[model samples]
Target: MVRELFNSIAKRYDLVNRLTTLGLDKRWRRKACEIALTYVDVKKPRILDVACGTGDMIMCMRKRLERRGIPAKFYGLDCSERMLEIAKKKVPFAELKVGNAEEILFPDGSFDLVSVAFGLRNFSDREKAIGEIHRVLKRRGILLILEFSRSESLLGKLTWFYTRSVVPIIGGILTGNREAYNHLWRSIETFPSPEELSMEFEKRGFKVLTMEWFFPRIAFVMVLEKV
Candidate 1:
């Protein structure tokens, strides 16, 4: 269902992101990549981006590393073929594959860093997907997740109102698919809080390095190291 929704919106995915996040998604992706950069130990790191829609995360990471003259190999995997199609054009140098996150096709301990940006909640089995991520990461490897969190504060509540109400309306008008955006909103509502997610990571054998909110506290970045 999620894959089909993404495939349906593949053409307008980037545009919708720009409109909904007010162009902050790029900044958020940069923050995630910057945080992951500190934990990367290899000169040519093996980076795997799961659910890498339109290759935004891959492109962000590559650009950051390249600016610092750090060489790295990039791979992107997503269940949506149309999304991968767009991603391939965006990052032609990176390897893009169509695959499920809950059952990653890579070998165990094959990656120095694994990233998923706003994609974890779309997974049907998040714990299993996280476990697969842990299995593919090398010892001391880092896992980066940039996802929506359940809001509680006053400011967060305002942001939640925008996300729950405004985003879907704008998305539907632009993409002509209101239901897809509805699914997105519902997913965010049901997603675990940052604290709960950190505990889940700990249970999966990851040492939670940092779990910090960016702004409005509606979205957060979680960094974990494989122990």
Candidate 2:
């Protein structure tokens, strides 16, 4: 259901990401990558961005490192063909693949850093995907996860309301696909809590580092490393 929905909305996915976040998604993406970089030495480290819809996260990560005059081998993977197509056009040099996150073809320890932004929740079996992420990462490799959070603050609750309400409306108005944005909001709500997700990482052998909270209580930048 979500696959077809995303494939249908792929053409506008990047635009929605840019608009719905008030362009703040870019900052979050940078933070996620920064977390990944901290765990890996990058004289040309191998990196992969899973569920890399439209490759915005990859682009942001690239910019984060390029500013430091460092180079890294970057790959972007997604199941949505349309999304990959758009991402390729935007990031011509990135290695993009269409594959399932839970059943990736990459060999063990293929990448020194793996990051997934707004993608893990879409997995029907998130644990399987978590295992795959663990498998693909080198020993002590960093896995950076960015997702929607459930906020506990009064101001955070207000932000969550906007994310749940106004963001979708704005998304619908801008993308002409209210149902798709609606699906995204529903996915965010149904996703696991940060603690639960952290536990999943621990179960997969990743030691938790830190999770940074954004306005919407559910939005977070979580960093972990393989033990």
Candidate 3:
């Protein structure tokens, strides 16, 4: 269902994202990339972006690292071929594969860093997915996640109202898939709170390095190291 939905909206995915987030998604992603870069001490870091939609995160990281002369190798994985197709066009240098997060196909210790932007909540089995991520990452490697979380502040309430009501309408008008956007809101609504999610990582042998919330606390970026 999720794959089909993403495939259906592949063409308008980026546009819908820009419109819905008022282009703040890009800034958030850039910020996440900058934070991820600070942990890359290796000469040629191997990075894997799980559920990389349209390749924006990979592309953003690539550009930033390139400017710093890091020459990192990028890999991306998504369940939707249509999404990967669009991602390929954006990050031509990235090696992308179609796969599930719970059962990543890569060998153990394959990457120095792994990232997921607004994708973890969609996984069929998030715990298993985290285990797979842990298996694939080099020891003490980083895992950076950018995802929406529940918020209770005034601004957060306003943001929730917008997501719950206005986002689906915008998504419907833009992508002709109101249900998909509805799922987006529902996922965010049901997802774990930032502190809870941090504990999940801790239970799985991950050390939380940082958990920073974007304005309003509606979304957050978590940085963890495999222990």
| C-alpha local distance difference test of each model | 0.91, 0.83, 0.93
**Candidate 2 ranges with C-alpha deviation above 4 Å:** none
The whole-model C-alpha lDDT of candidate 1 against the native structure comes to 0.91
- Model 3 alpha-carbon drift over 4 Å, by segment: none
Instruction: Please give the distance, in angstroms, between residue 208's alpha carbon in candidate 1 and its true position after superposition.
Output: 0.6
Of the pair 1 and 3, which is ahead by lDDT?
3
How big is the positional error of residue 161 in model 2, measured in Å on the Cα after superposition? 1.4
Residue ranges of candidate 1 with Cα displaced over 4 Å: none
Per-candidate TM-score against the hidden true structure: 0.98, 0.94, 0.98
Number of clashes in every candidate structure? 0, 6, 0
Measure candidate 3: CA RMSD.
Answer: 0.7
Ranking of all candidate structures by their TM-score, best first = 3, 1, 2
Model 3 TM-score is 0.98
Residue-by-residue lDDT tens digits, candidate 3, 154-227:
89999999999999999999999899999999999999998999999999989998888897567799999999
